[model samples]
Target: MKRLLLVALLLFKWMTYAQTNLIKNGGFEAELSYWRGNDIATISPYDKKTGKNGCTINQYVGEQWKGIDQIIPLPKNTIALELSGWVKSDGVEKGKNEWNTGKFDIEFLSSGEKGIQNESIAAVVGTTPWTFYQKRVYVPDGASKLRIMLALGQTNGTLFFDDIKAIPITQEQLNKFQEEENTKRMAAIEPSKESKVTLFTNGDFENGNTAWRGNASTSNTVTKEGKAALMIQSSTFDWNGIDQIADVPEKATTITISGWLKSEKIQQGKDTWNNGLLNVAFAGNDNQKTGDDQNISFVTGTTDWTFYTKTFPLPSGTKKYRIMVALGFATGTLYADAINVTFN
Candidate 1:
């Protein structure tokens, strides 16, 4: 029995190792070996909720870029990347500049680790519990590397960080990262034209129910490229459809929601519930709706494939974004595909 248990334990460890992603030492389980740190950053032992050590930074001196840095190499055909981590703070205060705050900064690099361009960071400030932060970006056409810096830029605070993750976006994910200009602009836009990033999990349905859950079933019969869930509603208030909850970066600016929709035999929902529509609700870390839901209504009755794009302000303290391609309380069959959410 002892030998059997030992084998089981080893198998579990191997399984975990096989799942390791692009971000090295992501959970800080191995201390600070994989990172280069300055004087203000050190390892916080065994305080993380995951039972792993976390990297902590003390920003007292207002000017030193004193923190940690890690460089990630990218493979060819990598179109975008996803970043996420957990942050805890105590008595944090912003610096003189708007960009100076406790946060993660990403700067793209070319071959031989040369600088390409710096991406905007979502500032982390104030006292807070363990908060999850995430960002997604489009990779430059010829870029080859990424530098992730964890620092309290010009901000005075104590921050603890763990579970840093950086994942190269898949082809399916890139399908959802469309291009968008300002909210009022009306013109043809291409995703590759602007900042290449995302906070929304790619719901392009190309991966077939990868990051989505709920009653709707994945179907390829009527998809853009023969993919997406077969959206149907069995009853009202049951929220019968596919939905996804994704993490958003703190202090992110404009949020653009874009997707494709197809409807058939749709009817008015009970009371004033919109029939076939895309409903987005902002939520906190607990996954409970914290504000009223917003909608991009779909035309009633049958319609061919129609694309939609909506841009709105990122609500304050929005930790989780709830996206629903719901039928509301209406009886209908619709298909929602390639739903992409991006933030500036």
Candidate 2:
């Protein structure tokens, strides 16, 4: 009996030691402690997928790049390491330009010198649900440090990261984890039917702002496909806009808003920051703003009517949404027509 008790205690100790997180504050529960970055990222208590907190990186308008990183010393003679985390994003752009997307990366370093840097293979664009990502890398000989980084490079959007971990693993275990992750990803990508419902009234402005409000009027000066469109003509230097409240169906995961827009001699003023900018945004049921405002297009000069669209994830428990269109800090005329909102 004594021998069996000793074996059990030994097993418990081994398990506890193995489960220790190698990265300090890996779950971000301590609010950026042991992490290095600018104010571009913050600890969000309510935006986490797991634990009590998560890190959020924001790439606001006119910003170039932003990132948060941590460096830790490598264990002696470590052969391989596995890194994993959960991430979600909104409006993250993707292109050949590395600067135009959101990325999570791991790099091995020799003291302060850079070695291998591996970025997440999955393309993070538009709105996404919480997803798991994992990567295993072989530690090169003489490597002294490992760096974990999350960045929003040139993309105008937001990224949330949580439940991060890094640990040493054997090659066999890494291979098995990779295969399992790939299989799960493939299953998730299988196409499934999604029900789409329109939730806006008088979206086409055919009824002449019957269900709309704000500094807006109906006119024939600019129309996309109908005889009338919502028009906002700025005679003086004050912002003008329009909005309508609509219900969102329960269990809806995605929302898409679109419209046709045109501008004539839109001018930017020194006092106005977002001058000549036309944009759309989705607000919560309480008439409170939610998420980032999506800019359809900005007009500094005369331009013909153009169609613009944006897709965002509908927040959970959101029973109602307020759609808004506004003209900021400029003079001239802005026309919008054929507005559409869809929930899926």
Candidate 3:
């Protein structure tokens, strides 16, 4: 019993420490002790997501990047890293360039890069209250260093960042995550009393596309429940679609997608791709698309509260999947609600 208790304590400590944030002054209460940057960045005491302070980045000139960065040495065998934090913006407008905005960027310094930095950026724009942002990427080959950058990129406005984190994920944690996902999926499928988890965020569109994004998509009152739903129009362009990227469990066997869709005035696409469907596109751990897309059933023409679902055997090498509502080339309006994705 004593030996079992020791092992249990050791396991608990390991699980707790595995997700410790690597950033030193991420909360900004330390006042920029470990971070480095230019005059555009400063510690703001008046507004913050947590604690006493937050990092603020502003660009009145809009001529250059106004932000800060911190370079951290990664631990040995860091499988993947998740960067996340809260962002609040005040009239943060971009320049003529599209990429200019509030950006939480990561650059992995790897020997295999040969000098070119591997960059992953999660950008925020316009005005918003306290909002959460996150990005997860696989560590590159021979990676030894990480450059965490937060900046207002050529945008004329004020932005505040707080409670940032750089979490190194291990294989053990990934296995546990996969196990939890399986539990949720099974709970949803079976008649058991286990509490089922809602796998997707804001799937019902009640938050008015808060968790969904696309050029041609907007939240409308025309919902199945008459509350709110995501409305997509093909007039934005051919292949106009809205999608959310979701992490796939490693070695996951199959995934099932389901949702209710409503369409009106959907026309023939240039390639007969015009329809309401789930396009499950696969991506590798490096977050690059593998060009393999499973286009589920099609809902063409006018429809009201039509249900669609499909189960696909996950393609090998998939570390993530993009769940998309696409109109292909068709011209019409589509409404989507209660989008769900479950794993098996």
Candidate 4:
């Protein structure tokens, strides 16, 4: 049993490692051993440097660059390269090439070129006492040589570099990095807490609002003397055939419908006992349909605001359904907040 458990643990670890992605921090380190200058040696005063703890190169103007001066060889399978370094500008801001900015620049040199193709960095020295800067470069295939230069760019003040790195990039790694960035952007737009959407107005039936239709007459769809209401015309009585509704998937296994209900009068002919009862049915006429209990509806209060809830199991062959708050067979005013459907 102990041996079996050990094998299982190793398998689990391997699975986790395989699923993990690149773009991880602190993956590679730069070696300053190749640097060649009297006044420069790679230094690390910034906290982002990978292995050497705070490795950095100290440089002074007119004394030749003193930081890490040599490029570390690329890995055997390396396809792309990204060179990043941190520099604090104390020297005068100068230098106009790819390698340097205000305080320091990094250069990449290939085997065939002698001038600065190996990649160099020069920076415009700033007066902030010390501030960090970073840069990244790409490398091509079949390239064998790499080098670093500190004084390639012209500047007047002291410059320092730390935490230098040369990283290998792959398509998969780039894609993963892009995906992480996209996720962060999306998370900022709609936080998980605000995922639920809410609408407070009662479809504009009350407050002198005119967004609802009733009995083919717009003049009295709303009332100020008593309670406001929404009425369905006899010609437009079918619930599923209504225009404001959208389709729900037939395979939806579970559903919940909840809203507020208050009515002074219900369909005029039905028993007053069942007048306030609301129904959510697939068919307009329950008698014509299966008349089964698959539909959900309830009646709660007569004069004041009352909450009502209904949940039902869907039939295997059911196609589409609509939400309805109908008075049995009577006529009356119903104020409602149509909040329906929550996904698990």
Candidate 5:
């Protein structure tokens, strides 16, 4: 009983430590002043020069060290190192080739590279309070030093940074992240239990339903006149009262997004778009709008009704997303059902 109690206490302490040990726990580690080109200080170092209001070592401009500027001691069985940070820009915003872009890059090396720096490019920071940002980086088996940089790009902007922590995540943490991701995906595609699908436009009937309209701009008025049965065909053009969002739960391992899609008639004409083959992309749109039928389109099948499904590993940082369905110059009909999201 005593041994059990002690073990439980140790586990509790470990959990507590993991929950609060993100980078930037104790403020800035060091500060660098571009005034003196060769001035270098320790991580989270003290700074006499301040920017904005009254800058201190904790809030100085130029490249600064986040957290304890201590080189992370390489672990024995470590696979990768994920570096993350947040920045608020405050510089003369300029365009490309303007020498005022708020550009910044994070560099990593086995040893602090004086010139040959391995840089990871990122967007420029603008006028905003310190916001949270993160990125997962894969480190080679034999890596040692890591450094983050902030410089003036074509859009130089005053940048403030905070909260930078680096720790080796265990396999357990990875699994938890995956599980959280799957949970978010499931949340996005929940069945509306009360999906009140109103008949907008039926090709079979001449003027029974109005043309597909509303938030999801759809048009189901075109039809092919048949002798016996009038064929109905229309794709769900847009989402109805749906927001473009991505969610992930805690402790997620593997995320699988699946749905039942059925379609009849394959547009196989010489003048068809992309040879009558529809495409479904994760993040792409020609009009640059969410759920646009023109982007991320899918193909239709000919013959009898058939179901199609696909599954893939979820990207580490990707949690939730919106879905878009589209139909091009095709004949016949199409229907989607049982759109389900699951985590295993």
Candidate 6:
């Protein structure tokens, strides 16, 4: 009986080893021996969550774009692949490119031709604690190689990566994992009906741009009534804006939108193309333009904190409305606070 049990244990070990980890030196245990990139190096800073050494890009001063990547040949009969790792950051910010947020990317090549590409499931930003990120992709026919990349583009910060792994997985397993994740996320954000009634969830900016979407950021430089406010700074005639969508209360007839805005060195360029202005607009559920578009043009020059209000009748068939505040096509800084939308 003892010899039979020993044989079974040996077979189980072989089976586990057969499920290979395609990535080499994934933990940076060998200290950058297998990774390649400019300004990429292995760091001795052990991750608290994983308790392992991590790889970092541009750990020292002198902010510049940097990345690390590894290319591995794919084995035969592979169906799908999953890449996962832990990432920690400090003071990471977005760059000129919309996808500039520090992230990991995976690319598959077939006969030296690109086939599949994807980035981390979510953007890594601000001072984040050690968090796990993952991406999964189907292996296309004739795929020959896979490239794994960790990148930071035009952003200032320190990013540490650890315990990276790439392995083959079944499509059913990937779908099960994604469904579990979505269910967890939905449960976490489930709020009471009273909380859902408000149109703008983070209008006060107290939650630090939680529901607002835009190229802007949250800052403590100026606040009408909170610890933080939305700040938008532009160096060119680019329209930087923030917006949110709120559900229209049933039987609502009118909606009123109000907010406080301030600007600094706002310039109205030589032509309409360069004009800078603060604009607020409301759109219907189908994203069609509504009659609620309002603007306070920076053509009037710099302005102190001012209150703006606009009321409009809810258009027929409008199930929800989107509110957008933007610093339109100019160079300047704009601060906004206490945005509120109400229904009668």
Best by TM-score: 3
| lDDT by residue (tens digit), candidate 3, 157-227 | 88889998888876556445433432332233222122432235776777775655454445566777557
Tens digits of per-residue lDDT for model 5, 100-180: 444335445565443334544334544555444444444443455555544444232354444444545444544444234
Whole-model Cα lDDT per candidate? 0.65, 0.67, 0.69, 0.40, 0.36, 0.65
Report the C-alpha displacement of residue 46, candidate 1, in angstroms. Answer: 4.7
Candidate 1 lDDT, 53-121, residue by residue in tens: 888888665555567888988866665566678888877786678766777778889888988878654
The number of residue pairs in model 6 that clash at the backbone is: 0
Q: Pick the candidate with the highest lDDT.
A: 3
Candidate 4 C-alpha lDDT tens digits along 30-75:
3334455533434443533345444334344553333334544545
Q: What CA root-mean-square deviation does each model show from the true structure?
A: 20.6, 21.4, 14.2, 23.2, 17.2, 16.0
TM-score of 4: 0.35
Task: Quote each prediction's TM-score.
Answer: 0.47, 0.44, 0.50, 0.35, 0.36, 0.43
How many pairs of residues collide in model 5? 40
- Specify the poorest-scoring 10-residue window by lDDT in model 1: 177-186
RMSD of 1: 20.6
Model 4: lDDT of residue 39: 38
Give lDDT tens digits, candidate 6, residues 1-344: 64356435533432343357788888887777778873465466554345556777643445466788888888776656656788888778766676667777777877675666554544676788888875444566677788877877667777778888887754444334333422332233333355455456888899997897555787796888879888887754334566666677889898787888787887754334234444444444444545544543343357787888877777777655666666654578878888887889
How would the candidate models be sorted by TM-score, starting from the highest? 3, 1, 2, 6, 5, 4
lDDT of 2 by residue, 1-344 (tens): 64356435433432343354578887888889888884668999989988799989986686466888888988765556657788899877664585577777877788876775554533477789889876545566667888887888667788999878877644444334323422332232222224543357898899997877555788875688779988877744334566665667777889888888888877654323335554554445444445555555565557788888877787655555656665553568878788888778
Residue-level lDDT for 62 in candidate 2: 62
Q: What is the lDDT of residue 45 in candidate 1?
A: 78
Deviation in angstroms for 303 in model 1? 23
Clashing pairs in 3: none
